[model samples]
Target: MPGILGHRASLPRQLAFRFLPDGTDDAAVEWTYHDLAEHAAAVATGLLRRELTGHRVVLALDPGLHYIAALFGIFQAGATAVPSFPPTGKRALARFLSIVEDCAPDVIIADTRLADRVAQFEAELPASAARPHWMFVDDDWFRRAAGARRPDGDTRATVRTDGPALLQYTSGSTGDPKGIVLTHDNLVSNCRALEANMGYEPDRVGCTWLPPYHDMGLMGTIMLAVHGGWPLVLMPPAYFVQRPYRWLKAVTDHKVTISVGPNFAFDICTSSITDEELATLDLSSLRQVFCGSEPVSRATLDAFRDRFGPRGYDETSLIPCYGLAEATLYVSGKRTGSAVKTVWLDKAALENGRVRHLTAEDAEDAEAADAGRAARIVSCGEVAEGHEVIVVDPGERRQAEPGRVGEIWVRGPNVATGYLGKPELTAATFTARLADPGDELTYLRTGDLGFLHEGELCVTGRLKDLVVIAGRNLYPQDIEHSVRSAHEKLRGAAVFSVPGESGEELVVVTEFRGTARQLAEEIDAVRDAVTAAVTAGHGVAPADVHFAPVGAISMTTSGKVRRDATRKAYVQGTLKKLTPAADALPLSVR
Candidate 1:
């Protein structure tokens, strides 16, 4: 497959963007390959004139056509593109500043709308930090850049397809965000892998509401569409969050055959979409609806299918997959036309680092289907072509047994080079060798825990996020899921282990909906329900059940709950407590 810019000349007239600003049909603006190429050329020329060809150019633009063009423009200019969203608040600003400090980019791209915010953030940067040249994407700036004629001797920089093109940043769900160095080859390889896994068809259209800064959005949508030469419908992430139905409505309107989102996206669409909204959607055209970027929930998939099945949404469209920033984007995904494959494993055996089958028939034979004892593990399909995926015992640095849960290590063309500047940390993470003899490959040690069954990968949980109590391993997602189900008003939950007098104890921080009066009224009842659920479901009671207001839980750009950050806030006693007494309840006896 050709790199992003390589497609411009051949597919100049090819439909590139059917962008819906308001996530509605009336506000749609169409852009072709020619339009993108022309816009990108101007930006590239501007960067070249500024002599930033070999420098890192941070894209702190909004999520739309201008951002997309600036990204490709950086690529065309032979500079490293550092994709990022504009900072909205103190937390987001802090994260943005961290990226700037790490990359030390020579230029930062933005629009006039964010001029004030960017100025404020730049002013706050330490005197030691390098001040980047800010180029706004507003009318005045674009006109200046686009209209300026290049010098007589000046020519387009040789875009390095095989060299470093992007410094894709991690979501910092477990720790501080790190820049993942991605070359054009790596991006192309992943896009080709996705095309192979999710077979393409004629007139295929893609839709995504994912944030453009993330890999899944950058590579999966914009880059993938360019690689596949297909049209893509894009909407702002805020629009999707505010009205998820708009995502589906765009799909229906565009005849979208492929789309992608995280597990929470499906959950929101399932819980929030109204009956009238559901009736208006016709998802029959969708053949591939990827649910990834976080743990794929079986319940979320089932609910989405059940709700939209009547409206022509097929269950097979939901492809539960796995990938991380280290491996570019795609690692493994279910192939097109294949039914969703799942395995029911004994929860206890899984916690012990073993995979024990608790098949569907076994549940039927039992008097009652106990979800607490069995976990449904979804298949992320076979490893991408030309890629090798192995489950390795992280501690022993050896290949794990066939049915054992361990860290997922991958080696392939899609795997990124390493972190931007952290050589020692990058070497440790990106270069790992198995204890097995005769294996010369150095794998990217993905900190994800999972096992392989019949060539399909089944992700269990994060290796770092695993909660250990009395030497027993527990997955926090299970506990969080149980807490979410504990009350009707509960929104989101973060489960983690905090230091205790004896050992690490479980702590629960959950978000609740409704007014302050309602929260004060339901605090005790909700706490009791959560305690009972966690104890009964996971056999471990939470040390502190902190009921927080909605949106209190820290989340990554990709909608993943930042457990580590939340834990830090919780430890510092900074997390807001919405309880009547403003105190976390101790483990209550059910």
Candidate 2:
């Protein structure tokens, strides 16, 4: 039997990937179909020799052809793949270790850079958790992967695993990391759904700057390209962040039709890149650009489309999508070629479970009285074929009323079975059933809150991130936006609720790009502006506003502000506090 990616070896000399360290159109390295398959076959042989056929193997490597081959090789060997987040520094290694402990993998295959740190991580973990054997994918390993022995009789393709094919750990942006167990069938089915939903084009290239550790990168770009047999152009996330123009340049040079990223990538292009760069980019070849793994901001969408509209960019190419690791990615998204749709509502009214689409006059009048309070939500599109998406009050375990705000729940063949080594969590998160007797399939309870409007899904905010105060519901993104606009000195913020004397009070922790020297003179003014903006927008001032320099706000590897961790740091008096005598501020958090 032909394995999922094994058939791609026969595509002969078909180009598989052209990667650039700086994400430029210039290729630092390139690989063909045979290169990927043969190298993966070599890695599979090594895994089989070590008898890791049914065990969990962690992959800790940066984005490149070699990393991709290791992931496919694990799948080819019938061993589950667990890709670790590329560690940011020594400080973040602890959190990375916690993830390994939770998954309890049998082995860790790491890139050359992390080989030494893995030993440090092992020394820190408990004896039981430190039992995982380490395999380094250094230069020697890569050379061996090129010329290593190949297992006979298709042993690399055969499977004996009782568990799923892929064990993807959540990025821990919203909560603790857990291994999402996705089977081979689940991944194949989801890819088919993606092709059908996005209107797959056979001729165009696949382009991405997302890191391979995240689901959007691993499944959407790497696995999606391999399965669809498309030549792909891949780049690391840092390269794109450093040179935002490179992504568009590669897309234009390669005639890439498909790409994916969070809303921020498009926003960065609109804000940071110069007009000279824009003139050089011709993006007419792009057909479907899926934005997910974070909230899709309408302002960001409009800015990107308008900024590039002159250069043959189509508004219909922008697709806002909703998915989670538990669903093996690509759960539901906008139909390709559909116009981007947005609904504006009165921010005050939106807190009360009403989705009232506002007229232009109403929105202007509302914003005039209460700046930064207009709520504009973009739809995440219709549910995928062979999937059921519903909104239910998680506390009641029953379906929500049409157009009523509730937790987003999804059930489909593409949803993963459960979280690895977490029976209670798996049951609570994956075994959700609608109170209705008719539909018997289990639903995965996405902790996100959203409502359906005329059949399209509109995600509001995470249930965990919702800020409640004085019997009103508030989304932190709106509050943070208001704060950012209220003061030029403020660069970033984390907004949440803390217990007050009467009820839950709003807490806003601000991070500034400027120095404490400037803040000593203007801090009072900044505070007043923030307070006034919060009062005008949300009808209440923040209970406490603490200012910290950049990097004071905790965040996950995916760049999501870890609100819970931030709150903990704030309560413990650990978040870096700005003082008049502190001299200067550190640069922005990376």
Candidate 3:
């Protein structure tokens, strides 16, 4: 809180949070530096009336200034904050309860819009089960906060640095949501590290369409603005989903310097926008477009730059980053103002744990002759100043060579403590040391595969999702990219591994917009082309190519494909497959 409200000697005195509800607007709700402290103080006093001190409180509010103030208020009241995706459906409510059970929160704060769903969820819990008290944001609460007998600013003067700040739950892509208990020190450390790595400027205006519930959205943009003393414009992820142009227009309208989002968002802006819609976007003011939260795609960056370069968007503004919720949302990022780096390599050599740079002739021949498609790896960036990013050979319990692929391990002051209520799992994942007797640093195994090139971090794929066939190790992302590039039908699809008679095989699961009846022959063509493109790209044909309904392919709240559960559903024959009758379709993992 010191960095947020106080210590503003050299920082800019600007608006704290500007709430942009949608993409197009004539005006927005603004809170200046003084306004934020006063409102946050009032919000904290309201929490005290609910007796939330030292208790775990769930925040399920929509993305806005209220949510930002509520977060700081939770800290002011000494309550452990647990931000969750606002329950939107039956499935979402079930997962929301799962998080509640894991964190054991006492109070849940949400918008009045979600009162019905919250009430229904509470009624369904067993008599003996734990249920959190719901505190909806109604008109009365606003009045109470505005007239609150405000708490003293010095009340949290002695807050412990190691005290639990919040529990950031995983998105449940690999498994059910697991809570990571991060301390105050962890949050401050990571935020400061981001400020340093990103070359923070107090005068810079920040913007983000990321949802507040996710780690990158919560800590990276919203909190970073407060802690670093900068102005910020906030918008909802739903708005961006509906109108991708609004995201860029806000940056243009506000002259934003730093903005954050994943790679797919860039792809959507490039592909989904119409010629008329693209005409309104002006991104010349954007300095750094922090691309992260999933695998960074080189093609996505290239497409976005090529599409918008005419509108004064600098190609160097696109900065690739890599990190996870476990590390407080930032591990490594490229230097500010540097051009992005991408390397072309031989696909076969990539599978054998080596990076053999592809010459211009080799790349052209691969693309033209169909002998093999060259693999393009984008460097996330050089490691942060105070953080150590290592490539470890999980099998040999040692560090991998400079150019060899291995599991990514990280160690820094920014790393969070172990997951909540899971001592054994925490030790196994969060506290691992190298086999060398002289080293004592404990690194968090990222469960991701990558290598170091010229001291830059190069991410390949997830270890659990890595596919091995015929003595070759293949990254599913490489295959997924090939399928998507081969045809538009496979865009935004997922590739995973399944058990095979030989070793492990590839499974491509995706959703097609049209029905079997509407698509007819085109659907059949897509199936054959999917198998063929994968064979040419990876040197092995997919065991099966699944086409399900638009919503059948489940994703986490933050939009990561749930490959493990997808594979399990495919094995159990539960996916609602289309283009072929379910029982008639011939599909098997082995």
Candidate 4:
């Protein structure tokens, strides 16, 4: 099996970037295959000089060309790369420290720009934590290392095919982050599976503004482009957040044929981009726009199409895919050339762990087609080649019946061996087996609730995130979406269950987007609307509707609403209340 490093000599010199320091594409940096290879070789020389081979090297740099160089450099030096978010502020620094403690890296490589913050982070490290060697990548270091060459031997022999290549950490939406151990074979196999599943053209150009530290950005885009031998234009996630239009503009300007983003990105583009900006985009060149890392919203997909379709954005270009860090990113992606498929099912039946497709007759029946009775689920396409995906009854540890929602289990070369340094968990999660006889393949339990409809995977929700009240399982996303739709002022919403006098009660924490005066005037009305929406949609009224300050809702790095974390904040009374006046709604302190 050829690893990523093997492509160093075979790939074309085309990957480029438009450096946007001040949100302007003034500096054009075109990095070719040779350029990246040479830079990576120099970085490898630097690492080898430090005797850091076969060690964990954590990257704490901004998303850019230098980060890519450092990643391949670690591969060339036979060291495991741990891509991490830069410790820019208190929150990020805390997460970074937690990752450092978890990985216990031998060295920490960061950009020179983070010198001050890095020093502070180092000082804050606990006494029990091992002090890691520090190296900073900058123009000066690159200049000094440029003269160094690859070790005198067959360059391909530098990295073992089955050895650990990366420690891709989870985003920790549910719990603490765990490093998924991906070997060189896993990386190459996943990239190949992506290519096999989603046919890649040699002349294809890619673009992305996703955070490079995450799996979708690193393996899905960066590593995939390298393996596919294509050019990829890059930009920081902050720039995209500053203006969602920049992402499409880059796609249009570069004639990008492939791109990837989460569901919130399309929603942001739909609501944020003006008609003037929409007119400037020519998204017809995009053959596939992969959406994953969170639930793919039907409303978002339809709205994005309705808004951008006139501007040549192909409806068929948006592909809903399913994947995670444990699968080395690309799991299963919708094939191109067809519009995305969505199945409207009875919400009650779905909540009961069954797939009941809503028929036209059901729609005609007024009582049956009540508001929120139908749940629209988007198909995540077929399993990748050489992979087996099965819905397993988690409790029974047996294969789920047809059309029954269960934990998605995957077995393939793309699946990672296990979580790093956790044997028991690794066995429990990555070595699952069915109860049926004559079935011997070990499967990785995805912990996602989904069922196969026809041949397509329709993900319902996460098993742990499901809210069971009165024996009815409610997906938080459905409740959150309803709450957001309840009022125009409602922006971000998180729905979770809390211990009540009863078994559990639903709590809604939301952020409003209007002035404080406007909120004060509409506070009572908004609360009433939210309560009605949740009650009508899920048959469960929220015990309390709390209006939080802007940015109060906890979100994962990949833009998922961190319901569990937000619940913790709600219980601790740490959530910032949106109090406009004396008559404002009182905080429902737990």
Candidate 5:
């Protein structure tokens, strides 16, 4: 035991056991380090008896002590853990089966509910191939497993640090999901980096309701708690969705110091909380509210702070961050106690590959200048320690200047190896370079578009998601923001880039807060405003503008807007809408 194994050996002894305060069966449910170690050994022995070693194991259990025990057990058995969301429908189940076939896991450990689902999948899978052995997370299994002896030596010794520890499947952003291979070193390095970046202490406590299937939920919250020996309070994602303020109340109840989620969670919490609820909630212990996994909206952050600040929520605790699964978790985060810094830029300059700063007064004079200006696109702070981030041209051959927008590339110990079983894509994405003398540099090509200003990373938009029209790059965020701001009736909108017969076109999908006829007028007003804004601001017009009821937008398990899926649904005529129309082209184009 050397680098990380040495640290792991002492963790059980040094750390304290703290379960979810509100929801456990009994006081005995709180497992100590010695108890966890013994349980892990029992699961490991059980797995070894089944001849399942050095293979992938999938876990589809809800958030609880057993789920945590299963994860540690898989690692203790020298196997890779593939944690995924429970299959929702036939299509999603088929996709999971396809992934299982590809990965060829040795066993599947799921809750009783999920086991039934797997049994249904078994009926469909061929009999020739080796079917995964199923293990149900139940009281019988726990009782039988608890009394087993602990493994003598390091189970992780056989597992190299460079080898894969976790297989995180992407949310089918491009198409079908592909597992991202993250190594032990990558995980440990990121945890250590984030711990340092967030200034985690031994006494700190974290509360999260994010689904474990999401990268941020697993790596950013769960693993970080384990590695740092912090007390963690876990809640079901459904619980949070049904009552968003429960997350806040949980924090208030537990005196939780840290929490994190996407922008939508904040929006939900702000929208759902009544004034009386806010008055009773005490969030004084809250220090860091990390926001990421989607486009971070300053408006959402500001509204949440304004609504809750009176109830002991600190406005300075707002920490807007930037990260993706490819890089493991976080890349950059704002410093604690700092207001989120946002810049307004000329929209035309941004579209035409130019970055020009604009002031509010200057924006009103010229439409191009107004179009050039983007608002409250928060600065995600400087690169994390032990990481190097650079903005490069589309080809990734040359570096971009400070004020120019380009693709973001990162070289760091925290970066993952690549997507599992996709060698061509791995080669395309991860590259060896000699950017500096004797550098031996390896960089991960993030499809995110951003730029560096005064050594800080400002994420503009996704490279693939960028809408190129009339030789300009129109980011979806800007379009969505413009449409939402255009009408008081249309709210909670998402704009996406849709391909048309001619080329790429902008599609604005909004949720109307009124009746259909009134919503139609509001939509028309949005369309006109968006068209004028895009034409004046970015020299392009939207191809179509659509209106739907509230809650029409699709989100991932982590609450990220599924722009690609939304576009697909719209193209297939599957999207439900009150009124959808093809708008007139920009006057400049006609």
Candidate 6:
């Protein structure tokens, strides 16, 4: 139940905090536990003088030492910290403002670079409403606020274990974003659980390049390193996107022992790295490559191991993990030194609620006949030490048999209480129940579709209409179902979710009984109709719509459309399709 500041008082004062090995920025940013405590006290005093207590304070800034200081300062002031990304465009900016309006934060501590943009957006607001006071994180502000005064020695204040510690907004892949309320106890419990599960030591060195706005980046990389008293190397997300090889080079250069990212990052690095860059790097110190944030692919992992093995990378370093913001950070992870295990199954049988593991020979034969494409699913390993996982049926009343797909439910001291400000939704999601009839416990519904296979969790899909593309979620069913109802021929049509270089997109593929001559016109008509429907329904535009002849759409033996298969085929350029119009409408059109 103790807050981060409370722990800091008891933690070692001389523990190493962070290391900046890039040598690009000249910022002398290094702090010990004592320095952190002093800076947090200064920040707390500044906020109290401004009459900002027991209110939400948004932290909208880039990653830096000042950002870290301000984050702890907000917590020390007994206020909820809302960590958010910088607004990129008009729509994103509007959404950010809306969230602030709803939360009614007392103040905002933002970077100087975004102060003008925030002011311009605020000016557009209607009159007669309370507006958040803003303060810029400039050099003058830091000198004034951090050097002004300190909290009274006799005033003893601290956050309870049940008090809100953070307000993390959902990715907004669905409708509007919801604020996930995380308490001090929830974070402390999860961090301890992760430490015990992964066997983290103070001597370990962590390196990561994921954006700080994400949950994995904030909790897994930053909080874990700080709480464990380990030295950490930080890299911007842009640096990884621009040159992925630099990430590997950093690992070898710094002798990083632990790293994590999505599966796409590995695939990109493996496919794009040059032989010359690989020759100069030494990766022998790399002990764990934590893979998560998306579906873990065995092909991607194997390819990475093969590509970097000769470069001193260990084959057993790849560890697939599973976690979400609802549980703070981690749920499960494979053992440290074990090679990833995958089971080859008959694709047809899997769709019919039956799972049969196949022999290696049978797997090879199927791949050979299908031009070297096999169905290999990897396990996410066992649940963390203090956490419990259960596979439950739709009624939420009974557990499913092994190998039978169902919703994944989690229960533990680390599970969060509920969403912020939505009591009905909170009651619906965080339910009270026991695994056994007489056991006293409760579980949180994850809304993730998966099943237990030999005591390992195998995630298949999502129960919600959430589409995850390139490690981001997208809501397409709401748009697709609306589109279908708008056009008569498209009724009951299937909407396919696809990710491109830009981002995740929605593709409405409708089947119609028509000849090639009429297909072109029908396709255009359907595209226009669906585009309008989605724009009106969701305020977002569809990327494209392709019309297919009756029976042209691929389906499983049981007649369910293989949406994943369809997406893969489209990405590989193997899907036969009707011709698109020469003058296709732009994405902004309604």
Which model scores highest in TM-score? 1
Q: Residue 303 of model 4: what lDDT?
A: 90
lDDT of 3 by residue, 426-447 (tens): 9978998899889888999989
Query: What's the CA error at residue 36 for candidate 5, in Å?
Result: 3.4
Model 6 residue 363 CA deviation (Å) reads 2.1
Question: Which stretches of candidate 1 lie above 4 Å from their native place?
Answer: 1-6, 116-119, 151-155, 173-175, 365-371, 581-590
Model 5 accuracy (lDDT, Cα): 0.74
Give the clash total for candidate 2: 0
Total clashing pairs in model 3: 0
Better of 2 and 6 by TM-score: 2
Between candidates 3 and 4, the one scoring higher on lDDT is: 4
Sort the predicted structures by lDDT, highest score first. Answer: 1, 4, 2, 3, 5, 6
Candidate 6 residues 108-169, lDDT tens each?
77777776676586776556546888867755676676556744541124567688988877
Candidate 2 Cα deviation (angstroms), residue 133: 2.2
lDDT of 1 by residue, 1-590 (tens): 22455556455377888888888878888888887776777788888888988899999888999888888888878899998868776776777888888889999998787776666887777889999988878656766766675766343577677789899989883236689999889988998899898876987999998999998999888999987888899999999999999999988888999999999999899999999998889999989998899998887788888998999999888788899989999999987778999888887888888998876977444315553777777888888898999999999999998778999999999999999878998989999988778877799999999999989999999988999998878998878888999999999999999889999999999998876667766667887899999988787889999888999999988989989889989999899777544343333421
**Positional deviation of residue 247's Cα in model 2 after best superposition, in angstroms:** 2.0
TM-score quality measure for candidate 5: 0.86
Candidate 2 lDDT over residue span 55-82, tens digit each: 8888877778878888888988888888
For model 1, name the residue pairs that clash. none
Tens-place lDDT per residue, model 4, 404-512, is: 8899999899999999889999999999998888878799999999988878888889999999998888999989989989998898999889989969998999999
- Candidate 3 overall lDDT versus native: 0.79
What is the model-wide C-alpha lDDT for candidate 6?
Answer: 0.68
Model 6: runs farther than 4 Å from truth?
Answer: 1-29, 124-129, 151-156, 371-374, 395-397, 432-440, 465-590
Model 5, position 245: C-alpha lDDT score: 75
